[model samples]
Target: MALIDCIVLALYLIGTLAVGLHYAGRNQRSQDMFAAGGQSPWWVSGLSSFMTLKSAGTFVVWGGLAYREGVVAIAITTCIGVSAILVGLFVAGQWRRTGVTTPAEFVELRFGRAAVQLYTWAMMAVRIVSTGVALYAVAVMLVALVPLEPGHPLRDPASGHLSLAFAIFLFGAIVVAYTVAGGLWAVLMTDVLQFIVLQLAVLFVIPLLWLKLGSGAPLAPLPPNFFSPTSDQYTWWFMAGWVGVHFFLIGAEWAFAQRYICVPSDTDAKKSAYLFGGLYLISPALWLTPPILFRMLQADADPEQAYILASKLVLPAGMLGLMMAAMFSATASAISGQINVFAGVLTEQFYRRVFRPGASERNLVAAGRWFALLIGAALVAVALLVPVMGGAERIVLTLTGMLFGPLMAPTIWGLLSGRIGMAAVTASAGLVFLAGLWVKFGLDGPLGSPVLAAWVQANPRIADVLVGAVLPVAILTVAHLLRRTPQPAWRALQARVDAYAPTPPDEHGVDHAPAKVVAISLGASGLLTLALLAFNRDGRGALLVFGLSMLAIAWMAWRVSRRRPGPAN
Candidate 1:
């Protein structure tokens, strides 16, 4: 990396930190800290939700898959959009209607305190460790771009790069600091900025690569199956199951539910989710193309590094730093979003509800900050240990498969149908858990039946979907139908939700400060892109396009900031 690249990256990190610190004093209560005081714009929440779903895994895991399998990766990932649309249409509004401060509170209402504890603790266990794995992956990728000389103080002598441990700690601390300082506001603003930078970086890559490849001729040599949407392991069945899994995930998962709850109204929540769905539906082609085109350039390139290598091949020095910043933003968006949600849950559900029942809102906010620190520390520790755990990624995938179906499916089912009680949730999840264990450990294992093993081998990706997604949902529905008794708490909550009506949210109050911040940040980024033309001439055309785009969005944001409240719809 050039000195200019380093400077650009430094500026981005500092700017993100500044944004966080800027909001430090704005959150006077736990609600403000955790959910932006229900004042965030629907679009902001929507974009944050989308960013929360990404991480370095977008580049490493999905990008690699795109490199090897062509368009199948997009087909698989587009399931996220399909799931989001389903949730937007059926579930997001329901969450907002419940008027719960956190998903844990909803769990407590629909099920019971016991279920809340079960759901919260289980989610934390799986999500925190997986978050650590993502953090580690980000560090590993970024550290590769920061090479060091033989005698450099920060260099790892053995591997001849910046020390991996140091890189992890550095990135982890940055995320934790910003998250602790600004809370949800920070997460939302940074996510919007990240989205802008990511789009600019990727949009530039396409035309540049096209010019290099000289149109459609170079792509002709690729294998025929490369263009097929359903490849070997990622079959249509797997994609359908993926959609089911994410539907539950986005619908009931605390992080995503936080997005719904944080918005102004039920309608806003639906809008946010719909925006997420719309973007996911349209943007995967743009997101996956750089890596796909890179395959034509170097068929033997490391799949995991396809995105970085492709960008590095075409992007000039300062723009490469912008790309790097965008990549870091992906992981930071996810990690910080999770930390914020976990802290909010711990603060609202445990700290205030159990220990300090009469605690003031300020006190609750302080406690939430402390909880954020604790969670961030734990996540960083997990990342440090990921190198020792060879199967960390696999562990995340397996746990997500096993847990999302048994845990989240029942939660979403309970949200939509009041027939199922806590007992039903327990029974459904328990049965699925047992079946999932048997499938994973018995049939898929060496000591199990040879016939079953062969079947599992033949349908490698199908078993998890069947056991994890399809079976749990089916059981939950059956259990709901069989239940003869109605639960009072569920009925009561449903009555409250049904009776509630929302007044128009104050447009002047909603995201007033965040809007200006976004405008200024984007405007500054646009200026910086234009400034790069003075130093590098080879990439002038791409830089101009990026600069103009950022400037246009910044102007729109400025207009939004200055708009007066109109008649309520």
Candidate 2:
């Protein structure tokens, strides 16, 4: 990379660190550190959340998937777009309403101390492994693209075999340094700058790639599944799932909890969610197109490797370093956000609640920071020791599959299941989910799928999240009949949910009421879902999903329709 590009990259990263440190003292109260005094501007909070939700892994994997798997992959990207709207409608205002420092706090509030603690510890466990994954992604890419020297700890000094673990650890140190110092303020504030760099890097490269390799005639001669939804390789189930998976996993998530916390109020937060949805639409397009262009330019070339190659050998020297830095920002921002929240939840729920319920606020906050540090240190150790899959594509997918499917269960149930307690539910789900993923990734053998007894050897990180999420849903189903819920807890929560949620305030403040609002939401979801189903008949589903989503959103949003946010109770 050129000296200028290196300088720019270094300056940006250093500047991020500096800003984080700048706000280190802002945590006058424990809540401020995690949620920035609950007064972050709608725009800044919204943007930070959007960027955090979209990671380097996301950009790299999705882009690479498009190139390798064909246009059908774009449907998956579009799924994230829809998920953003769901977040706006369901998650945004309610998170703020809970009046908690972390998402796990909602568990404690809605279920009991036990559920919150269990979920928190489980989530942190997931975070440690997930962080390791993020580190691997950023580090491996750096090893391949940037100018790592032979003796560099990231690269093997002698044998030249990839020291996958060391690379992950090396990057972990960088993320923890900035994140531990700044907290959410540091993370979100730095994210604004990171978003600018990351977005521009991907955006600029796509055009250059296309310019270098013009688009050929319509890609009709490709394999049946190359881009066709109707093709065997691209079934409607998979296409439809892309929407479900990405929305829950990325867009509508507790992963970006601070974004909801930092908003001025719940109503404004809802606006941010919707607005961010629109912004999120462009990311996959930007991140995926370059590799596709590269492959078209060199038709016989290995499309899977084209993305990494272009970023490495194809871009101008300085731009390469800048791009690497942008990716680091993307990966780091996301990983640290997860780490910070996980740490906070672990402290408040497990450590403080179960072990030292009487701990002072100061002690709880201290625990949060310490836990983050310890987790960071552990991940670094894992990064230094664990062996990762050789190819980035295989490593990422296997990791995502393990986590993506199961994690959604908790969030979904949290939003929908009113009486079901989260503690036993989360614990059951967490165990089942992780075990399933472990079986899928390890015990399954060379492929790391769930079918084989050899799946025990699969990458454990991915296994944890996927199984953790999926198992909970299944367990909850049985638990619904067998496991008894606390009657008082259920009654108390229902009371809270009912009193707070209001009918949409039309131009006239009539009591639009719950029944009317429910009708609208159900109607909207049904219409769009049918439209999507109609895609087999001239792409009707493709055209109407957006309109239907918006309509369903309008109904779901009735609770937050008022601009004044009803005085925060």
| Predictions in order: lDDT | 0.85, 0.60
Q: Which ten residues in a row have the lowest lDDT in candidate 1?
A: 502-511
Write candidate 1's Cα lDDT for 241-310 as tens digits. 9899889999988899999988878999999999999989988889899888888877888777788888
**Best-fitting candidate, measured by TM-score?**
1
lDDT of 2 by residue, 1-569 (tens): 45555564665566566666777776665676676666665666777777776565664566666666566566666656677778788877776665566777666666677665555655566556655656666765655544455776655655364454555665687788777777777777666656655765676576556555553433323334655433333455445544555555653245665677666567867877776787767666667767666555544544444566666544654556657777888888777787777766677667776799888767766777887788788766644432443444555555454555554555555555554555546656566655764575455456454444533344343333335443455666665656555446556655665565322333433222222333443344345334333223433432244335445545554544333433321
* Clash pairs for candidate 1: none
